[model samples]
Target: MPICPSCGAAVAGAVATCANCGHPTGPAVVPPPAIGEVVVDETAAPGPSPWGSGRIHQDRQWPTPSRGWLTAGRVLLAPTALLVVLATLGSTIAGRGGSGVDDDPAVRWTVHTFQMWLQLTLTAFGTPWRNSNSSSFGSSTSGIHVLPYAVAFGWLALLWLGQRLTARARAAAGAAEPTGPAAGAQALRTGALSAVAVLLLGWLSTGSSHVDEDSLSLSMQVTTGPAMLPLGLSGFLAAAAVVLAVDGQGALRAEAARRRWLGGWLLAWQHAARVVGALLVLLTLVSVVMQVLVDQPFPQSTFRALTVNGGVYLFGVGSGARAGVGGLRGGHEGTFALYDLGAHGGQWWLTVVPVLLAALALGWSAHRGRLTQLDRARLAVLYAVLTAALVLGTSIWLSESSTIKGQVHEARIELLGWSVTSVVVAAAAWAVFGALVVPAALDAVRRTPVPVSVPLPAQAADEPDGIVGTVELVAEERPLVGQVDVLDSHAAYRRPDAS
Candidate 1:
């Protein structure tokens, strides 16, 4: 018997049109039984979503990367508060016999550059509160710098402002949903690249001592979460929540225009700044070399200050699941011991290089619409390795730490040298945090609804053929209980296109 082309109903093999819908059907596969998730109507013309349903779409057109009014505003939102403090500090250093802080344009510019970094660092705390104490974090900074938490909060506020503006723009554009990356994608890449520059600075500034040393570490006794998560991560989570809230409802139609700018610019900016911070660190090496040439100049220690920091990241991240169980036992102490980067830190850069490359590749993957389930799973593993390498490298650097006795020694050159090195490295780290954050934000920018088209997937053809059919096994008479396939058990026929 022939099935009606339109409705896939049995037609005694001689029907012209479907008696059900009074429509003609073409060379498409016969409809299947009313089972599983999909229900096919032979007579209806398919639209993107179910009749009135709205879903986010991925394709987007970009705006001008630079020179936009909104862009300028967004730029100012960050680095404003930190710049003010850095400028004051830089001036005080110069005014108080700090030659490097003297009335020099380069020095001033460097200070400006450094301020950008300082802001990011403070921002990490997510809020500002004063009362400097090295005892614990998310607490007072002894009024030395703005409270870390405050800085973080400020960053959040500014970021939200930018988002609000962008959301408005999306609304004006008639977008039915919120979707798109933030503006900092480029900065994220810049931060990643800056890692290399920091290494070079260490080599240039300090007359290289390839030895290990003991340093203070709180990590040995505790396991903790990231002190501060980039606001962008929060943003990504928010977007995912919203996406879930309205799955197929047309209510989220406004998200379309908002997602256009989402994706990896912040990474680039951060890496770029990190490069500059690294240069400042190299000045320590310059101070040492200069001291040798003329009088003894400023002297600074090596990379031994990050042990605790690195240990914290590793202990929390490596075996996070077992941390609690191990914590009760003494074996889970998170203290970072002496670490060696084989060949006098020659391999240090190797760790950094691969991470940079991975970030770029991931960006490309996002560009290619490959952040699907499988791709995302693969990328997650790649990121874990990259993060581990970073933690390892930083930990190793702690083996050469230069201690602070709280006195001006080594002709003040040493003090200046150390100050520069500390700030520079800190700034580089600042860049990194921002860089990573930007991508999280951008990737989250996919608020626009995606449209799923029907007609079956392209791979429906090429199966071995026997027969193709549909069965509407309704439970009107015999109700379906528990779970059952309901349709043909063997699915004997191949795809109609294949046959």
Candidate 2:
């Protein structure tokens, strides 16, 4: 019997997968060559280059749990402290006494610090809710209004830094054999841990609130607990994404084994995941621009505004708005309204256009691959529908609303289901159309014939020509042909040139 290379467990000589750790045993079980035969490295250099470069670099190992945590702490601490200082400085500059910072300094240093860590970690999604009250009925909001593009830049930097930290930790710890656990299982574990950490941090931080006396007098609570469920959910997703990317470096020798376990559906899901991840990041960027162009009256609550707006942009969900005005009688007439497709087409285009282009590109790429026409179409449809649903569901789940208490006239807020339906329908149509057409168009263009220029030899000034032989050829031209066909062409032969 042969032993499992990954876990040192016994395996039958013919078994392909390890019984203990699931690593593929095939790659490790190749028979040795016969004694007389030898192999040579034809591409290898004769010796080291003059600059002294002959060493091959090793792959970075995955960090263990303890190392990963230690790295997370070091990587997160500086940013958290810096953000805290910046938040305080910003408040001081704005003359608001750092209300955006935690109410208690201790909380700011510990609980809020972790909150900040979670916030930056989840920056790829959007900024965390500031939980502050709105300014007077129509005053400028005060909290940090993080732009989506900026957050994206920060998130990318964080990703690079995080990966680098893990690499350094792994290098220090020395390379070791991977445990060969399932990728999905590893991702789930890290994602769950991150979510729990965020939830606990939010819960502990919520105890200290930055009470807004002015907003409270108006019968509104400005500061409250962080949106724990949403935060945890976002954290879990963010962590999972990072974990998957990191785990990509692991189990290089076991990918075939992993693939055997993961069938066609899993393979398709992986592709879908890539598209959705890209869409999310792209939409986040679009949402940032949308926020800038469409100014909101509530500047004091800009943090929540960006958060809600980002959610709406990503999901296509509707939102509610309340307005108060003076009535003919003594009382104020207030109205509440919801727009399923709350964002304007102009704003929606900011999202729709990029996604559409991405879809078309994806279709073309798929067409170039081993997938069949049906596979390409199915994938395109899958991507389009899923993208739309993601936006719709996110909108419904993460929608935001604020209350108004000022006196004014008739106010009305109504839900427009048809608009939401229209949005969804439009998305599906765009996706299906793009999926079917873009690749076909690309293929057609690729097949089109282009005229090639030929150079004729220069005539000699004084050369004697003698009749050598004569030849005739037939030629014909056609506008276009789909399939390959031989065409007749006319050719003429002349005497040979003598010099």
Candidate 3:
């Protein structure tokens, strides 16, 4: 039996990972070198392998279970704690505003409001809110899917903090962080665990109320239930996306060169991140400008407004309002309309210019050899699909209903949402044209041969120089190399034909 180098625990024969500490132990057997081949000892160096060296770069192991759990707890606790404090203050202020109810009722109202907010956060992450009612007349049920961008921001921030802490802890432990496949696996695991925990917590913290009055012969029950599957899936995805965004470094491009599928997926994710990030920055700026122009008095109000609008706009969608009473629905267009650059005359350039510039830049980089043609195509397709999905996911609807004397009245509204045909189609179209078509066109232009005129050997001073002949030279028709390099220099290079 060999002793685990990371934790000094006894290990059975040929195990890759230690059970106690979850650290990776190198392979048990070293194959003999082939004839005429020399082998260098990887352990000759005292530290981990340098990055981009085509080797696994780690000196220590993954975090111990205790550390991992502690970090995960903080990831959830910190954000929830902050939200709770804010909710308490806001609820207290609202309760004291001379609204008749002021004592225990006010306190109960505050707690109920906080619970509703928590449910909303879960709903934002894909949980569906269900309302059920039973009365002497009849029973009715309704559900809504609404995403409150403010809560989403907090959720993202929480995940980001968790990922950062994980990396920092690994560094502090003298461990080289995982990259490529390992990073993806770790992210998936972390996200799945966190999501499960959150769903359980939400279930436990669910708030419900029941009323029974014999005098009026009225009994009503209301419970807000968060669907398990949607919530878990959404939470897991959010966590995974956050982890990959934080820890991804070329996503092991060098290591996974032979695996074209994996390479393309990773490459797509990187580009998607870039496009989404750019769009978010643009939307945030627009929101800020609008806020300043509107001159909102309260800073808190401005911030809240920005978060709400920014969240919807970030996904390229529209919002609307709706109302209903006992199965009949009616409402007008929402106050916050979709920012469709396509529909806005003369301002269409706003959308085209940025995307075109980004595409051209990427095309130039690809032409210079940063990315191959196939990689670019993959990126375009994946990016478009991702954008469309994002738009769809951000669609939000909130419905609340109550029965008074057997008359059920309901108010439904779109917090942040979209229409599949318009928003989804527009987003996908933009991604395809801007991210794919533009770059490919640019590549073709750069590769085209250009004619250059040159003066044929200048006439000697002694000889007659009255008429100097000019020669037409056609530049070589080869692929244009990008001036900027985004890929690792040391990785194996393949020509276009070979690729």
Candidate 4:
């Protein structure tokens, strides 16, 4: 077996891995000679960059508000427009003539594609929950509903993008192998459970029959329909904003990092995601405005008597359909009060969070200030909490704004739900995220304790990157240990004694 340099273990000659230590034992595992092998693999070891440690670039700037707004505007623009336009098209052109993909082949195909995409967008059908809701919680969707699925789908996309950025940061630092594959597998496993739970919640949201608590038939329409585009858009916009915030670096330093194409892709995706985000925001805003300010009629039906696991469903005229697809008078009311409260509580108050984050994100660009893990975590926590709160509040409003028998417990539960959601959001932002960023930030700019001067590579002499990556890349050709020139002949022969 070949000697194992990594583990210093003995093994049979010809064996690849060391039998004792399982280290690489055969000839150095050379890269294939196809497309010029990348000789170095400086897995981000737990040490400083070649630059001396404790020396974060002394000159740093703050992220500003203008950039944040610009980013946010870009992110929300497309989705908003799409929702409004699609709803209008659906109303004027498609007409709600059929139910459950029972329409034209084109309609069926389109809906099917979107639905499948949503299903696979986030954690697969078997992933775990990221929230406090346990595996036993109830869901508010049912029978091929669209809003929740779409929102979930959009969120999945947004998160995937952001996570990719974080993943790159790890790779650049030569730290650890990316474990996103594992997390993805986990999410996929947990998703199935989440879907079932959420579906129950959906059924509750719709009230089994038409929401009949009020004369306004808005509840019935919501209960009977799908609101995929708007909700999906919300997730997309929010996710894009977050990814833009505290996570993009390789792109920011693309030229220096020698990744022009990748950098271009990042900027392009961000712009694309943001445009969609801004559009969605606008559409949602318009829909809300139409419902409350435009005085549109309740386009949905209303009913007061529908039982769900013994729970009742309320009716409403709230943002009647006349306003727009995403208008204000949510959908259901009464028995689904908890959901209503949770949903709207999230919506009405937290809109400012994203705006604030976007501002911070763009500000960073102008200031040339990268977020410390702590700073980024703080911001992420704040935004994530707000986002969740908005989701809960909006969901509640959609499900139970007009209750037939709104009770004290229901009100308490609603408020409690919101409060709990807010706190959890805050906590998650500060805790789990905080720990992760510390390592990542340090990996980016931390200096080495034993600083050694590095020579410049011929090609990279005037390049923006410092000596670190190049030095590590050349470490193998120039080994760290070498034999002394003048060893004594007597010492060389001393090993002959059978010690």
Q: Considering every candidate listed, which one attains the maximal lDDT? A: 3
Minimum summed lDDT over a 10-residue window in model 4 is located at 304-313
Cα deviation of 170 in candidate 3 (Å)?
A: 2.0
TM-scores for every candidate against the unseen true structure: 0.22, 0.44, 0.56, 0.23
Per-residue lDDT of model 1, residues 87-154, tens digit only: 35544454444543456645554433333333324324322112222222222121111122223334
Which of the predicted structures, 3 or 4, would earn the higher lDDT when compared with the native? 3
Greater-TM-score candidate between 1 and 2: 2
What is the C-alpha lDDT profile of model 3 across 151-190, one tens digit per residue?
6666688778877886665445434445465566656666
Q: Which window of ten consecutive residues has the lowest lDDT sum in model 1?
A: 409-418
TM-score of 4: 0.23
| Top-scoring candidate (TM-score) | 3
| Runs of candidate 1 exceeding 4 Å displacement | 1-67, 83-164, 172-376, 389-499
lDDT of 2 by residue, 181-255 (tens): 433454566567666765665565453344446655654334544556777797677766665556444343234
Worst 10 residues of 2 by lDDT: 490-499
- What CA RMSD would candidate 4 show? 26.3
lDDT of 4: 0.32
